[model samples]
Structures are given as structure tokens and as C-alpha cells.
Target: MKVITTSTQTWQAKLAGLLLLCTPLINACTDPSDIGLKLDPEANRIGVFYAEIPLSAYLVATDSLNTTNAGVLVAGGDISDYFGETEATAYSRMAFSTSATKPENEAILDSAKFSLEIGSLTAEDLDETKTFAAHKLTEPILDTAYYNFDQLGFEETPFASGSFMLEENSDTVVFMNIDEALATDLFTKIKDEDPVFDDIFSFRDYFPGFALKGSPSQQTTLHVNPGTNTGFKLYYRNSEEDTISSVYTIYTSSSRHFNGVTNNPTGTPTEIVTEKNKAYDVGALVGSKALLGHLVKLDMEPLSNFLDTLDNVIFNRATLSMGPTENFPDSKMPIQGLIQYFTDDSNKILRREEDNAPYSVQLGTVLQTMTDEDGNVVPAVTSGGTNPLVFNTSEYIYGPANTREGITSYVDALYRTDVMRTDLLLYPAVVSTSGTSIITSSSITRSLREYVVNQNSITLKIYYSKLR
Candidate 1:
């Protein structure tokens, strides 16, 4: 992915002249102690590499996202010249998967709807239609959780509405059209067995679910999937049958639903990522954004001060490279790759005392190749074409396992200056394997201002071992 038009302040002025030539040979070492106890029984190796060290990229955000039952529900609004208008609504509760049986005569209502089921769309939203609606939830999707900036209050009309349009691979759905006095008051309380169908907390105090929005002038973003043929239907017909089938339905409560979100960054570039673990400065102001969560903090302290000016070093191999922005296009909206994590200084996500879990990886996409000035070979596209996220980071700067006890070998926790220092964070993922199991997540539905992070193609490289 050749997009390295190079210049993130030219690798911060070449890692500030390699941290001023290794801080005066690390403060003129007179040896206050342990330089691995001054090695040299015959030590004289050498092998250096550092794609201009000091990497820094940011645009951090993400303050919330539990979104209860978040198996994708999201709604509409999608625009982004760099994450500006986002929107999303969905909330749920419905129920009645059992109990309540009365039909036989007197049921008359024949027609109501609601549906949902789409599951994805917004690979740059071509927009053939969109509208949607469905209101009626005057608060109550709570039996326990929901987050993503939660919110409530509804019923500003829209007992169902539509506009829809999808059809391509098929299985779309959407629907809407309800409101005939709220579908005849739930068809006169199931043809008169009322008492709110006596269960599930009196049918959630007599109905309290359905928000589902969409319609920010149809830029587009759907997702949806309340599955099992999403619900609400109603079509009865018994008043001595003269036609008109007999459905009922309600669904959508596999544990109350969620997805609230709102994001409005007032005109793009995520309005300088404004706080929440702050760190901005990735080029024209900032970049990394994905579903308002943003993220891209990488500070490997100038490659740990250039491996503290070598003194019998060892770390063999570490890659890193980067990609995405050149005019980013090509998308089934999965962002393609990047997940890295170790973070600290309040960016949290640290864990790993052997399975406390969090020292992650997975930067993905390889297959680069390149030669062509007749040397031939090719395929290395970047931006719209793709292929360039390489992050194998040699088990965090390989330090010969440093006697492994509770595992503190990220190069001895970056040369432990009494602790607190371990950066690397990147995030904008989506890996998915599952037949042999691989799964990685966090692609933040619809980020796409060319997705981001081409900070001059980042780099890193390392292969250390110098002692001369």
C-alpha cells in the first residue's frame, strides 16, 4: 500500500534527531548500575533498524458502548467528510412470545406492520431511498442495560412510516405502515382477553417498545436485524370472517435492546476528538475515527529511546507499517484491519498477567509485493485498492523472555523507569474467521472519511542486536 507521501513532520524531525543522539549516551553512563552488568565476554554483534522512530498519531474518543444486545440494530443518518453527522436510534422491548390466546370470533383489524431485518448497508450509501420511522416508545427499554449514550422518549407521531428500498442480493425487509388508531388498539387487546395479556410484567405496562429511527435526509446507514423476521405485524380478521388472514406478532426482546449514539462533531474531523483520553495530532489536525469512538494512539517512546543507545541489545524483529488514506474508497465497510492494544496513561486497556486479557494484536493485510521499474512483481495498492497493514510487533520488542515470572517483557516494560509506560493502541478492526476461530471486532459501523491513518505510512521496522 504505497501511500507514503511521507511527512508527519517527517517523522517528528527524525525522532528529534534520534532523541538528541541518545540523550548524551544516556547521561554519560559512569554505570550507576545494571547495563545488563556491562556485557562483553566477546560481545560484538550489530544490526539496527528504525524507520524514523517516534511514531505518534491520535484522534481519540469512545466514552461509551455497551449498547445492550448490541447484535447490530443501528438506524440512519450517515455523513462524514471525516466523521461529522452520525445518528442512530433503535431501542427495544416488545415481547409476547407466548401466553395470550383468545381468537375465535370478534378480532377485526386486518393490517398493521413494522418489520426491520436488513442487517447492513452503507458502503458509502448510494441511497435509493430511506425514510423509516416507527416511534411509540414513551420510554422503557430497561430490564437492565443499554449504553452508547443512551436516551429515551418517543411518540412524536410515526406509529410506523416508510420509504424503504434495497433489493440487490435480496432479503432486505423494512416495511412500516401501521397507525390506524395504533392498529386498533392492538386489535382491541387481542380480541378482548386484555389485562395486557397478563404476563411479562403486564406486557411491559401495556406496550413500551419501538423507536427505530432513520431519515437525516437519507445519507444512509441501516444495519437493523431484529431478526426472526423482525416484528409488530397484526392483521387479524374474525368478526365472522369474510377474509383477511390472521397474524399477530410482537417480538424484539432478546433481553431489551439498545443503540442510541448521536455524534455531531460540528463540521468534521471529529471536531478535534475533543477529550476522553485526549491526544490529537495526526496530520491536517486529526484522523482515526470509527463510529464516533475514534482511536489511534501510538507512542513507543521513540522506539524506547532508540533502544536506549544500544549496549549489548537483543530484540530481534518487529514490523508495524500502516495504511488507508490516499483517497480511501473500496469498501464493504469492514475497514479491513488494525486492532493493537496495550495502552496506558489512562487510555486504559492494559491487562495481561497471563489471561487477564488485553495485550492484543492483529494489524492484518499483508501481500504487498512491489518492484516494477521493469523489475516486475506488482500488487501493492493502498487507499481504494488496499493491502498494507502490517503489525507483527515481535512479541513487544522481544527481550529473550526476560526470565518470565509474572511476564514483564515488553522490553522489560520499556526499561522500567519505575513503571507507567507502554503505549501502542490503533483500533479500527474487523477480522472474522470462525470455522477455526479468529473473531476480532470493533470496526465502528460506518467510519469513512477514507477511514484514516496514513500518517505518511507509519513504519517502525526494528530488528535489533548491537554491541560492537
Candidate 2:
């Protein structure tokens, strides 16, 4: 995408004078920069310039995300015409609770079961039922992290299985009966104080973990929380004459669990962005899709080139305003907002030059009301206007314009250097700031792919102090 150069000069000076006057007032009667002191806009016959530059957006596959110890664990299948078929398998290591005690001697094993604490659900249709199976993992979950695309080996036969209709508020737990024989063996080992039960690490070698796999169903995925209360259980009678029963439970380790996702993009819009073609333009096809390992990459080469034409320029405010496509489906809630980060060539987020941490921002969300042709006021979404996703880019263009010298070590590298370029990746996420600040993982898609970038409404609006 390129800036409409035809109107560049005409639009540059439209708000030049007005912004110069307002800048001083906007800064709360403080000088924004020394550049304003040196080159007065009115005295030098210069003003603040503005230009709208178009940007190229691609719905590209995101780099594999680290799913280790992810706050939310998802399982089952999520099928969509827009995203294709996405399946998730959860792997978790089971450990004996610190207070876990052995069952009584001569205890008769009754039964065993595995259960999942369902946190939430993302489904195309709730009427459809999904069958989930719990298979013993062949290997232990590593202390190291696991990626969303990572798959661990598990037993072919499932020891337990259950079927149920997925719901967000209705169901709390999904339970499956475990094999009696296997349950009895586990009961005996605990009663006999087997060496494997000596420690959590030792026990993990004998019994690795459980891999919860779901049968393909409608687009429905369960966010399961296999915390301390959810896992394997053994029920047994203490003795022949004892009416009372004893229970021993193995809890899942929170720090040692992760979800593996498999996305088959066959016969879907995402198919175009396969391994060979990582980035595909969202020209007409409902804009760009997110999650299912997908992201939107914005290239601002045209805007960078346009910025080169001006000299002695101090950019006051550079805002990139954009929003979701107007034709977004009504079935799914629109993504609240997007998180932006600079990306490397591999689409991995780059670390900031100052702190070595990735620079990210929750773009400002704005609802701009406008009058239609018939003189009726309506929300932008109603009139197909751009719902504001305004991102401040002044610091990225140069240094902080409000600073004393307006010079910083972290500035100027991004836009000027090809090595560290100006490409940005946008992910569907919501940042919460209640007590503790929390950012939702971009890997968890909610199974709703309606939040696509509005290509037509995207504009890089630059506000610059045009000093000659």
C-alpha cells in the first residue's frame, strides 16, 4: 500500500497553523520542545504538516507461541469456515499432593476417574456434543517450556472417555471413568509405598501424565483448568467389612502443563497463508483473520518513503488509525482491541533498545460518531466509518517530541534502518488493569475469527512541525 501522493501537498498545510497554536496549550502551558523555541511556526512561515499514508496489511501466520504454564488451557475441536479446523490437545503432569497419604492396608480398589475443571467455552454451536478421551502420556512433561505447536507422545488407547454438549455457563466439569485394572494397579502401588511414590519427580517417571484428546466435532473448544482439584482419582474400600471408602487423588501440576494446537487450513481462507506463503494480502476476503496462529502484519514502507521528502521536520503526533472490517460477522463479539509490537523478519517481536523488553501497546479505542448523507447521526460501525484504533507513532518517527532535546538513543533506528525495520504485528488481545495488570494471550483465539483489519479504512496520519 502507498500514500495517495496526489493530495499530499494540499492536505499537508490544512491543519498546520491550528495544530501549532494548540500544541502549546495542549502541553499544559509548558514548552513541548526547544525546536519550537528555535523555529516559531508563524515567524518562520512554517506550520505543522499532516499526511495520510496507506499501509499494506497481511494476515500472516504468527510464530509459535510458548504455551508452557499458560493461564488458560484449551482442548477439543474448533471448526470454522473462516479459520478451517483447529484442534487442541492438553498435556499435564500429575503429581501427588503434598498432603497425599496412602490408603489403608488390604483396601479393595473400587474405581478410578479423571476430570477437568472447565473454565470457559468457545463454540460455533453449543448444541453439538464432543467426546473427550484421557490417554496416559508416554513421556514426562519437561521442565522447559512448550510451544502451542508442540505435540507430545501419548498412549494410543485412552484409559478414560466421556461425551457431553459443550457450554460456557452450564457445565463445570467433564468427567470420565478410568479403567478398573489400571486403577487397581495404582491403588496397590500407593498402599505398598512404592519407590516411585517416594517423590514427585520419581513418580512422574513411573506415571508421566494424562493427554486429554477430543474427537472432532463442531467448532467448539473447552478452556479446561486442570489445577490442583482436577486430575486422576482412585476410589477404594478400606477392608471387606468396612462400609466406608478411602480416596487418593493425583493433582495436575500447574507449572508443568501446556496445550498443543493443530490447525488444518484446508479449503479455508487461511489456506492461502500456508508454509510457503506466510503472508497473504487481505484484499477482498473479509480482511485479515487472527489466532489459529494468525496475525496481521503492517508494512509502512510507503509512509517511510514519504517522510524522507521533508527536511528539518519534527513530527508532533503520528497516529495510525484503523479498525475491524465493517462486514464482520454478528455471531461473534468483535475483538475489543489489538496489541501492537515491532516484528523481526521471522515475525517474532523485537526487544526494545532501552530495556531489552518487547515494546507493546494497547492501541487507543475510539468510537467516532458521524452524520450520514441523510443527516442522521450514527456510530461509525453503523455507517461503515473507521472505528478508531489510533496508535501514537511520534516516538517511533524520531525521539519524544515533548522532551527537552527531542533526542533519544532508542529513536530513529526503527524507521531509518532496514535491519530493524518499521513492520508491526497486531494481535487480538485485551489488556486489563484492575488490581493486577493482565494481558490475554494472543494464542487463545476464542474460536471466533471475525476481527479482521479494515484495509480500506487504514491510514497513517502524520503530524509534523514543518521547519525550513
Candidate 3:
């Protein structure tokens, strides 16, 4: 009872497969040993011939089959070669007997043994590789956890718990469901001396080409009896049914706010802040390098590259024109820095009593309501939910040191004629209701706005005399 090995034929099939797949380089560079294709040098493995058909079938005993003992076939006896072409079932295309299941059972007749022999297998010859009754199928197949006899081998083709008769020398086995998770584990077990040869046990019937000592006829005959589960290969072709494709670029993020926003919507009552939401769409200038510590800007690319960094630079109501004095938002104190700048720029070249200084303006906005798609009245955060523009704090950009703000100084410097010539814009479309439609609304709004400004940013400028 000599044990035979299929290492030789297996290598030939692999070579042919490699050439067919156009991966000749892999075949040439790889070694059967390095590739993990090996076996007990003297041991023999059973070999069986088979054909693949769509349906399942069993191997039956046969006699009176045509052979050197021919004429016995023409003689036609009651006895028929059950496994032959005549009595053969058309749909049934396989024959797996006891001898094929175990190495020891395969006598000189069923057993095949050969020595190392190198050979060639072109893509065209790949089809010539002998196939045996074996398979690896997908799991939970057709609901019953079926398996396909078409299954082949790679590193490990485990047999399910009760898939076969406990035969002697049964090195191959199948698991209920073998996925990539188990590929490595399975490969390690069945690879004789070379774990790399594990591919030979892969159910996909795929193998990397490696050196072989013999011709293509020396194939390892593996017997695979599908479990109660049906015949289906689960993700047979690829190590993974799903692929990992990831893309990575750059990213950035930041938080910003315009200092003016803290004041809130112009008309909003201090108590009303809790009642609404606000948004800003208009471009802002505060975030600019001006106002130094009063504003902060950042490089947004760090957050998300795709996201627009353009608008990421922003102004914080907290940091707006505010100085330690505190009127601006995002600030703990008032707009002292601004006051300093105003004082600096307003300082006369020689403090000439008549020196006229340059002038600039700060813009702020008021909050308003908008009807969203849902027809819900939404608080518009525009400019701290205030008006669309700033107070034009610039009027104070260059004013007398004693002025509440350049604006007030501007007022002081103005004469009756100058005041008349200077154009002032009321946030309301109409100065007072009298100028436009609902005169009533205008009057009320103008009165309230004047009062609020006078109370807040206005008062700070007047009393501080710090040119805030």
C-alpha cells in the first residue's frame, strides 16, 4: 500500500493557469516549496477522474465495460457498466468511490504515484487538466447551507462536520462556511511543509504556478461531498466579495463670527434674543487683517480640503471692534483698540486746533425674519440679527479726543450747512413712516432705533471721550 501524491499534476495545472491568466512572471519567480506546495515525499494520495455536470449524482459499480476485454460490450449482458456511457445518467457526471476518499484504500489501481517532473502548460492546455470529484461551495446555500461539488481546493478545503465518511489519510476537510477570515487559518493546516502551497486547497480551484518535478498527469484527486447544504460557492472567486477602496485628500475646519453680530438684530428687543434664529449671507470685512486682536482668521484647509476655506475666515462678534471697554461681541470689554486707532489716526500732526483728520466708517447690521421653505418664520442672523450695515463707526475714525465717537465728533464738527450736506441713511426703507408706506411703522422704528443706539454704542463714545 503505497501513498501517492498529486504535487506534479498540480504544478502543471498551476503553470497552465498562470499562462492563461497572463501572469507568467509569477509562475517563473515562484517556487513550489517557497509557494508552499509540498507533501510527505513518500506518501501517496488517491486520484479520481471526473466530469462536471449541472446536477448531482453518485458513482455506481460497473462491469462489462468496453476495454481490452472488448466484444464483451457488444455481447450485451444483463450486467451493465453503471458508471459507463450507456447506463450512465446524462445529468450525473461524477464518480467518487471509497478508494478515492482515502489514500490507504487506493490500491495500485486507484492510487497514483509519480516523481518530480517539469513540464509546460499553455493557456490552451489548461483545459486538459484532470478534474476530480471535489468541490467547495458557499455557505447557507439556498437556505439549507448547501454546497457545490464544483468546489476546488486552495490552502484549505475543509469538510463540514459530517460531510464525509471518516476515512483514513483524509488530510483535506471543509468547514460550514469558509470566508477570507478563515483563508489564513485553513491555509496553515493543510500545507504539508510549505504553507504557501495552501492555494492548492483553495475552493476556487485557483493555484499559483510553482516548480514541479513531473508532468501534468500527476494530479491530486480530492473528493468533496457537499454537506446537507446545497451546491453553491460562497464568494468563491475572490478573497473578498466586497473590496476596500478608500480616498484621502486634505481637510480643514474653523469657527468664525463677525463682531457686529453680538449686538443682535437691530429691532430685536433684548428679551427677544431667545425667541429666534439668525443667519448671515452678506460678505464681511471685519475678519480682515484690520482690527488686529479684534478679529481672528484661520486656514481652513486643515478641517476639510473639499469644504470651502474661502468663507471659513470669519469675524467673531466676541472679537469685533471691541476693546477692554466692552461693547463689541466675542469680546469681554469695549472696543478700546478701535478707540486707540481712532485716537492715533485722529491725532493732529502738531495738534493744530484746526487739524481735520481722516474719516472711515464701521458697518453693522440688524436682524430680521425670513419665511423658510416650511413657511416658518425664522430669525435671520444677519449682522448679529441687527441691520444689514454697521454704524459707520468710521465717522469717529478721526474726531476730537473728547468725542463719544468719531461719529459724534463728526456731528460736532458739522455746521448747519455741513449737516444738511451730509447724507445719513436710515436702516428703514423710509426715514420715518411719514416718508414711505406705513408711516406708523417708520416712526415707531426710527424712534426706537435712535433710542437704542443712543443708549448703547453711542453712549460709550460720548462719556468715554476715549474716541471709542
Candidate 4:
């Protein structure tokens, strides 16, 4: 997004004054950067999420187990008879959910029950029967799914948009394309005001009922109460100066969070909610819908811890799954290494069930690298996918499916851990700048907007020394 650059006079006096002020403050203060506005939160808030990305990669499936027990039950089932049985050859299709959809969306993707080598894939080296535990997902896929969409004769849309009943009588669909332009423009405007970034808060929100692209962005949805004019259209890299009037009012619905403000004149938007959308009479008041809606603008206390854990979680999975495309050269069954996490603890890191699982987060240490009969390292390959939420079981049944090799394969694709992680990761921290002194400021919507150039090139620099 381009900056709304405007020239200002008295530039000579301001630059000299700033250097002088900096000299004294820099010497006096231990950390001169610490001097800035203090932000206040609006209220007690928490974040609910559905998806996120990892800072690095991690391992998922392994060949060896580190349990003290000769054999422990695991989700993949027992391997007690691994060595007893013959080293059979079986194959399963290689695939990864580059995208995901809401559980509510119908299964259109030809998600095949990848034929498994049940007999050949034995954990016989294991002395005891082990089972991979069931758990919830913390960060599931929140994007589009080509596999399903292509089958359903639907094309993937580049944007996320939706509409709700304004109230009882108003039946208008709010179609929006909250593209990069919106974030860029908004951040630029914000930076134009508060460059020091004394108080810059970030949060994430979701619109469970609205999102269409796969699982969608965890913090993309938001509930905007249009004090009076209940309508807004957000286009990236744009600035609107009151087309007709300087004011506009947009009302919010119940739980549905909106990704952006877009009004489309297409499909006949039927009334879903019975309530009227005119009750939004107040200005700047946090509506109850904020909580009900999945859009979580996560804050400090919750999101920080969540992000710390989530980053680690996704990184592990990404490393294993996102490898080269050609994982196993010259093999009929080309399976992409979509990493899967299995913890035994009752209270799993993300979410878990009652199991004598260990209290260790050292998943990497315990599970050994997968190898073939010739002791060949099975290369884990993928397209660098985050934890994509499996929205359904019918398409690709995970639990107890018979393999071509005459053995029962049990699996329960879970979004519990991914879900829990998503909710916690996207709680946006509310950041506001307040002070008597003036500095160049820009919006934090887009990270790039935070940098101000041609002047000091300092981060979040406010162009104006004082409010005119």
C-alpha cells in the first residue's frame, strides 16, 4: 500500500529539536526505546482460534518408540507382533491437506482411504500393545481445499467474505473482500499517526459461520458493531473520504463474525437470523457477539503463551511433512509426509484423553526416524503444510479401516489440539498510543507499514512532531 504522503513546513526546526531532545533523553534513560505511550485494554478478553503457522519444522511419525514398557498402546495400534510377523510389502496413497474446510462444509474431495500395508506395517518390535491416543487439534487448516472444491465444481475464491441479517427486517448479504489493500492502507494511516509504536496491540478473530477458504485465517474474522450505519467495504490499499456523507453506520448480527465489509448483488440472501440488525445504537461499545463469534483478538496474557506453544507445535509438523515432492522415488504409492502428532498424556499439550502417556514434550527424542526393510531412511516429503484440520471422516476414514494387507487400521483424525491452539493463538492484544508528545506513526495492520523512510527511517516514526 502506498503512503498518503503530504509535505509539511517547519521541517528544519523539528529535525534539529528532535536530535537535541534525543541527546538528553538517550543519556538519561537506560532504554530510550522504552519511552512511549502506555496502552489500556478494553476489557477482560480471550482468543478462540482455528489455524496458525509454525516458525520452524518438526517431526511427526517415527519408526522407533522411546517408551520404557516393552510396548505401549498407541493410536497407530500395537507393534508387539512386529518382529514375529513377516516383513510384508504394503502401500498407501501419499497425500496432504494443503487446505481445509469447516466441518460443516460437505465432503466433495475424493479423500481416499489410502490403502495401507497393514500386515507389512507391524510394530512387532514392540513388546506390548500400543495405541496412538486421541486428541483435539490446536491449529487446523484454515484455507481452501482444492481436492474437494474441484470435485464439487467450485472454484477457490481468493478472498473471505460473508453476510448476516442486519436485524429482523433487513435482509442484505454483506459480501466483502478484505484483501491486503485494506490492511496495508489501515496500517499506513495508523503509522501516519503513531510512528513510535508506544502502544501497538495485535489480535486475531474468526468467523466460523462465514469463512469459505479452507479453514481460513484464525484472526481474520471480526464483529464490527456499526453504531448507526451498519455497513463497511474494506478494500486493501484504499482510502475513503465519505462518498456521500461523512458518516456511515453498520450493525452486527449474533455470533457470525465478518471477514470484511462487501455487499454483493448476486445470490438471493435469505434471512437466516430472525433478529433485527438495528439494535446497534451505541458507539465503540464491545458487543456480546465478540465472545460468541470465533473472531478472537487475542491479548498479551493468553496469546503469548499460546503462540510460544503453537510455533513449536507447527514447526515440528511442517518439518516432517514439508519436504521434497519426490519422497520415495520409483514407488507406486507416493505418500506425502503429512506429519501427525501423538501424545500419550491424559492432558495432552493441545488436548488429550485418559492414557498412561508420558509427561514429556520431547516427541522428537522418543520417535525414531522411519526406515524401510533395507534400512533405507524413508524420506518425509510434503508441500510445507501447516496442521490442516480434517473436517470429516467419511471422505478418509482414519479409525479402524481394513488395509489391503489384511489388518485393521484404526485412526481418529482430530482437530481438538489444533482447535485449542487456534483459539489461544489469535487473541489480538489491543494496543493504543497515548501521550502529549508527537511522533510519526503508522498502522500495524501490515508489518511493512511500520517502517517510515526518507526521514529517520526509524520504525513507526510519526511524521508530525505535534498535532496541528
* Model 1 lDDT on a 0 to 1 scale: 0.56
Which candidate has the highest TM-score of all?
Answer: 2
- Number of clashing pairs, model 2? 1
Q: Output the TM-score of candidate 1.
A: 0.36
- What lDDT tens digits, residue by residue, belong to model 3 across residues 1-468? 011112224555544332333222222111212221134533212211111111111111111111111100010001111101111000011111111122111111111111111111111122233221212223211112111111111123322211222222333333233234333332333222233323223322232111111111321112122121212122211123325322111000110001100112233222122311111111221111110111111111111211111121111111111111212222111111221111111121111122343222221222223355667543232221111112234342211222222232222222111211111111211111122121111111010111011111211111100010
TM-score to native of every candidate shown: 0.36, 0.67, 0.14, 0.15
Candidate 1 residues 335-412, lDDT tens each?
455556667667756664434645543222322233446675432322222211322222211111111121123343
> Any residue pairs clashing in model 1, and if so which?
none
lDDT of 2 at 297: 74
Taking the candidates one at a time, how many backbone clashes does each contain?
A: 0, 1, 99, 100
Which sections of candidate 1 miss by over 4 Å? 1-41, 44-54, 60-107, 110-156, 160-178, 182-223, 226-228, 239-245, 248-279, 282-289, 293-368, 376-427, 434-442, 446-468
> Over the stretch 347-436, how does candidate 2's per-residue lDDT look in tens digits?
766653444655443221323233446675422221111111322232111111122212111122223333333577766554333332
Return the candidate ranking by TM-score, descending.
Answer: 2, 1, 4, 3
**Span of 10 residues, lowest total lDDT, candidate 4:** 446-455
TM-score for candidate 3, residues paired by index: 0.14
* TM-score between candidate 4 and the true structure: 0.15
